[model samples]
Target: MLTIHVVSHTHWDREWYLTFQQFRFRLVELIDQLLALLDADPDYRYFMLDGQAIVLEDYLEVRPERKEDVRRYAQEGRLLIGPWYILPDEFLVSPEATVRNLLIGERVCRRFGPKMRIGYLPDPFGHIGQMPQILRGFDIDAACLWRGVGEAPTELRWRAPDGSEVLLLHLRDSYSNAAWLPADENGFVQGLAELRDSLAPYATTSHVLAMQGTDHTRPRADLPRLLAAADARLEDTRVVHSTLPRYLAAVRDELGERESRLPVISGELRSSQRAHLLPGVLSTRMWIKQRNHACETLLERWAEPFSAIAAHLQPEILNLKPLVDRAWRYLLENHPHDSICGCSVDQVHREMVTRFDWCEQIGEEVTRRSLQAIVQQINATTPAIVVFNPSSSPRTDLVSVEIEPPPEPDQPLLDEAGRIVPYRTLGRRRREFFGMEVDRDGFAFLVAQFGSTGGRVQEQLTFRHAEIAVEEGTAHVHIVVSQREGARPGPFDEALEQAQALLTDESIQHYSVRVVEDEGVTIQFVARDVPPIGYTTYTLRVGATLAVAHAVAHAVAQKPVGATLAVAHDRATLAVAHKPVGATL
Candidate 1:
């Protein structure tokens, strides 16, 4: 007998053409209806939450009152939630990010219910090579996916580079194949026949899967009745509501002895023949990719290691793990297939910038604090430069250090040993501090430079005035500014007029001052033997030298009075003679 497992699921792209908040409003309505159906109808069986745990958080954020409803449905084996935080694009993010995605997803899902064990990747552009091994490490033995595979049977073994394999289930056409199953008796009969005939040829066993929903779609309210009609009308076929896990279990039982004979496919699945890979997303909105890599590097390479070192050296230091995790969460929010792939609408990508900013800000501050904590225990009275190497290999590289009070242009630096360090001055620059007093003209220029209007800087007087500081205990109001690329000089005219108008209106009646930049010298010196995952400190010494004496060599060679030249070739002479028979030379 043939068994048709109808899996009801909605492939939720959290943010695509619509911004997250906009799509979130729709999600609220979908879940509200889903909870009602699952509560009222026992035969609805199961509804997959797009194989992600993040959707639950998104849902609960708006429907806090429905927490128990979600918990009840999930715990009762009727709602399949997560083995992934979000279905991320396999190639865009770091391998570590992928691991964290699963690791965090598993933890969050298990809190209220049983987590799905299958690697349920319904829609990623392609699958990665090591995915099987990664899933196996997490105790997952099966994977279901929709794209990036060529012509093959529905069931096969996907192997990782390390030889670990998983039972791979291919969604041949799409996850939306059975999205509109017929409701009436005649329509059901026709639909089941077509589905059975279409899928049976590819099935390794007598079971075939029919996914019953599409993107952001609610479950069919009368799905149970529809399945019952098909079951009764069909001959020698059992059509029932089922989930992916149960279907896979039945397939395993059927293929018990024939499992080894299943075809094995390995490595990354990025073929474009079966489905479009959307490869351009890798290069589109490239700034987003750049910022993402920077944020990941800051947290993983710098903040994390320093925090670990500080925690071990100074137990009394403030705990930074919470802050670090928060930053990581912010970063991961942008890792979804649609979000990080840069395939979403303008507003969706725009919101990603703010999240990246928050993540980077938190990571930078945490790294600075951790290093400061470690520096406090260094037991040095004079100023010193601390160079840290966060990689596994020892480093020998030049490091730039900004010196206060402007050092001599040719000043030599010294290490812990009394040896002179080879150094050169890159140049000097004025580092302006925030909240510094500036004249009306300078204030206007700064405003025009940093502020942007409509996400562009081409128009004058268009940028919004973000902030203006009125200083206390000083006769000056502070205007903070930083240099930005593509900012023009003439746009400051309107900003100047606005600042003057504010001053005349008594907003800064008592304040009148001019800004002056501070001078600092930047010097580069070679840092040697910086240990892996460790730090080295260097000191600047004035007029310091080693006591060892050096001897000078005086030697020269004179050309000989007579020169001789010699050339050697073969002693025997050769003649250009041709010895050919029929062929022309």
Candidate 2:
């Protein structure tokens, strides 16, 4: 009979320099107490290690003898594997940072003993899509995690958008919280008993009783008693202290299965949903938007100041390069899933707003000096101002541009042609001018008039396609409304007719569609109102210019018009729209 292997881990969220002496004292005391307890037990041993304790280099150097023992214990496979250093927040970090942390952790482990195969991330706030590939790159075979499951599945597997497979063994819900904050020995025993009984129904020869470290503020006196109780319980179940590598090896041998080709990490797999399986869906889109906005804001504010400082003291602030690099890396990691921060949607939004403010501050300082050098170098030429509107679609051609004016009230300003452009009076002493209209792509060119008072000059510019040439000396803009290529008469009216056709179709009684020009098409399907076990289909024709703004479906096609857009029934969300040339869609 295969014995039940029990694995225990301690996840110490490192706050080294911030907490300073207090943190060191807490860690040292915990280690001392844990080591004493483990040394006293001959039958049972504690697998203890700090979580991302890379910053403990100074303390470790002072205690050479103890460090040697730790190294020796690791060589004998007593110490479980973790990352080289502490990762700030798994969800908040970039894929590269994650991989770097893993590599560093593995390197540290190799310094003492053998390579670690299983990655451990007991609690990542949530999972990121790019993590699987990162794990695979590090040669990690499996990982453990707890927070992702709201509901349990029968079996576990590594999943991603690309269909890569990894072996997954989710932590049982009751056992997960119980392991950390066990109520009593009886309660702990009961939870373990339930887990054993649940596994009885499945074909399992061996099992792992994984638990957390008995340190921290959480009282866990039940662990020692529960370990003793399990010793006397089942015939086939033998409670042995195990690490991830040992446990994975035993499970693989017991199951007689070959090693999986996929990389495994600790998090919820996104591949289970068909919507994520689609091609060209990058996980970093949301992060990219936040980063781009933050970068632009920084460049605008501090570029000049930063540039002047660098020029004045050439190599004086070179040491600050590491700080800048670290800051950028942190931003890259946390940029993704900014929407999923905190416990709820509103809380997440609040957190994002706060972080965005921090990013803005950092950007302003960095850009101030950088831009000063640029201005000095480009002083000989007329500075061209470029504005960009970042959105999925085009905006109204008209936009506002505000610039600083000259100090003198009567200062003469000349256009490229040396002509004084006419201005509209905005206030008692201020004046305003209108520029060309900007098109959907948000690109426009305008000449500014020189004026005194030197405060700020504001103007509204309109954008349009270049092909629709404006009359000489006049700003004549043409608007192009997107419509289908072969649609007769009104495309919006044709879409409404198709929507009405679906309403009359007998096969699609469960579904309904309403066409709203701005919001695209609205689809509603009430499954409970229809037959329980049957499926239905509805079809509608939409103008080629029309796109799917949002959709939701169960087993059937909720909106048959989705078919015309080449959308599959299994997709949870789809955004289909046409894009202008040289624009991001």
Steric clash count of candidate 2: 34
lDDT of 1 by residue, 1-585 (tens): 999999999999999999999999999999998888988998888999999999999989999999888888899989899999989988888888889899889888987699999999988889899999999999999999989888888999999999999999988867888887677778877887788888899999999999898988888888888898889989999998999999999999999989889999999998877788898989989998899999988988888889988888887757898899889888999999899999998999999999999999999999999999888879765678788898888998868888775543223455766454555667656543334455545645544554434213333222222234455522443222223333223334444555555544444434343332225667777788999988888776543322210100010013222222122224221111111111110
Q: What TM-score does model 1 achieve against the real structure? A: 0.78
> Using Cα atoms with residue i matched to residue i, what is each candidate's TM-score against the true structure?
0.78, 0.46
State the weakest 10-residue window (summed lDDT) of model 2: 512-521
**Mind giving the per-residue lDDT tens digits that candidate 2 earns over 41-105?**
54445464533434334246545557766666557666544554444445444454566566555
> Judged by TM-score, which candidate is best?
1
Model 1 alpha-carbon drift over 4 Å, by segment = 408-411, 429-519, 546-585
Q: Clashing pairs in model 1?
A: none
**RMSD of each predicted structure:** 18.2, 21.4
